[model samples]
Target: MRLFEPNTAALQALKGSNINITLDIRNQDLADLAASQDAVNSWFNTNVEPYLNDINFNFIAVGNEVIPGSLGGYVLPVMNYLQKILDDKNLHGIKVTTVLPGNALQSSYPPSSGAFTSEASSVMSGILSFLSAKGSPLMINVYPYFAYASDPKDVRLDYAQFTAKGAVVRDGSLSYYNLFDAMVDAFFAAMEKAGRGDVGVVVSESGWPSDGNGNFTTPKLAGTYNRNFVKHITSKVGTPKKPGAYIEGYIFAMFNENQKPSGVEQHWGLFYPNKQPVYPVF
Candidate 1:
């Protein structure tokens, strides 16, 4: 499934693809919307209801990586209001959730030691409760690239790219061969510790940048990472921690967004602006 922040042109472009979409609600004051039923209704009517039939909407992400802070406090309330609107409108197929950054967790090393930060604990609890009640998956954006970029001296490039070269991270008896798997398992561990192990996880965003400051952020490596990722998820092998569990994921972007910040931000695209493939993704 592909994810897109709601926009008229993009939605129009996807009219008949029948591809599942995770629509994002961005740039709006979620707190204000949560407090007012009229605002939520109007926003939905303008942004979603009109395209309900033409678009294959599966999830509504309230905000991307906005939690663990003051803005994060609005997540649960906004999700509740949005979910109620969906239920009232009989939109049962579309689940409401928010995307969280990998940094939301205070610690993720060793995978098993995963836990949300103290600042995020209370808010995450409420978010988890809402997700559990609504049967929505907990969305998280995991980027092994950032981890490697932060510590190139210690972090193995091969491990971050899924080519571990026989290297394994021993977290207890479990051995993690790749950073992606370890990162995902860490989130699972955190969720379990948070008392909501049953709630499913969706990798809302994961990808490598083709061009950036780091040496590893090259077109070839990006292609390799994405291609391997597609294979990994499609094989249904799951991660070591959540064996046999189906974890739905979406690649970071469809095109290189030039307006984004200078470094890696503009380079996480699978395609160029002219619609040519960056690499053979399939």
Candidate 2:
């Protein structure tokens, strides 16, 4: 389970549950948290400290996809500060990390050829170093839907949705039948190249839109993708690159945000605002 922020009500409701939670710092508040340790302490005291005993705080994501941009510089500092605070409080299990978009990679095709873009590499090195030393997984938002939608001519629908019958891409001896595994392996490959292969990855966000884009965005495709994704993760088959390794992941949205920018962005939800299932894969 994940919460975008430390919502008191949500934390209270989830208390006593066995669910491990990945709590995120709001993107807009990254500046404040980075600016002062006092701010971080106060934020934690109010939002996290009160619920620590009951809530299983597994990961505390400093920011989401804020790298390779203006907020890029703040990520590492905030992570370091947050780690110190967590250590001081004896919250060792709660890993401090940040989420990055798939675009962080300059080349991902062929999987083995994966490398972080120059823009992302400089920022990533420090963060990846920290993760490697602390034994924390890098949070990545993997969406094969976007890759397929941008180039349907080359990306097969079945492969993207994990319904492919046979291997679609052959890298070395590794046979990739699904785009999800391929995308993930690409990141692993990049991490290996960066000399931080010890760091694992936790997929922070992934989902297919149920509307707003021709046949690519439909309830059937979304259902198929999400259902097969769940099965794939639970199977523990892992990616061809790391066979049998357990993967930790979370789907994009629990409810559709009608207020998001028009089109596909508003349609990634598993449920409607009215709490109705959008074709139920859960």
Candidate 3:
């Protein structure tokens, strides 16, 4: 679950539940936090320290898709401070990383020409260095829906939905049958080019919207995508680049959030706010 603050009762309920939690530091003042050790300490002390033993905290996401621009400069510093804090507190099991958007790359076609955008190169280098030092996986948000939406005429629905009848993309000897694997493999190739091939990858967010402006944004498709994704990850059939490697992932959201912006932003949820399933998942 995406955690912004410490909720005592909620955290208590998670104790012994066998559920892994990924805490997201959802604050806009990331630069200030990185500059101030006391702020970092206070934030962690109140939000994470008290619940460390109660919740199965697995990863501490420094930020979500806040890089490759003005705010990007603070990412590595913030992650470094957070990692240092965790190390000092003996929280070795919990990793520190940031969630990157697929657009962070300059190019991703063919999954072989993957590379970070020029604007993001310096920041990405630092982030990769920190992740490598900490032995943490690079968390990225991938959405095949956006890709298909951008070029529907060229992008087949079956391929995007992971039910491709034949290979839709061929990169050298590697043939890609679906967009999900292709997108992930693209990121893997980018990491390899960045000289961080040993670093692992994690899909921090991925899910299709049940309702949106697009024709494909239907409840049935959303359920199908999520269910297939669950099976894909659990089966240990990793992306072609890292075959058989396990890649951890999380569904985009659990409930439809009304606070989100209109259109597709508010629809990527498995359940309605009233606790009703939009469509059967799992």
TM-score, structure 3 vs. true: 0.94
Among all windows of 10 consecutive residues in model 1, the one with the lowest summed lDDT is: 257-266
Candidate 2 local lDDT, 35-111, one digit each (tens): 98898888888888888889899999988888767888888988898898888978888999999888888999999
| Model 3, position 89: C-alpha lDDT score | 81
- lDDT of residue 44 for candidate 2: 85
lDDT of 2: 0.88
Q: Which ranges in model 3 have alpha carbons more than 4 Å from their true place?
A: 4-13, 258-261
Best by lDDT: 2
The 10-residue segment of model 2 with minimum total lDDT is 257-266
lDDT by residue (tens digit), candidate 1, 1-282: 554466788888888889888888773667777777788888888888888888889899988888776788777777888888888888899999888898899999989999999888879998998889888899889898889989988888888888877747998878888999999998889989999988888899999988766566778989999998888888888888888889898898888865543653548889888889878889
Cα RMSD of all models vs. native, in order, equals 1.8, 1.7, 1.8
Candidate 2 Cα errors over 4 Å, as ranges: 258-261
* Reference-based lDDT, residue 138, model 1: 91
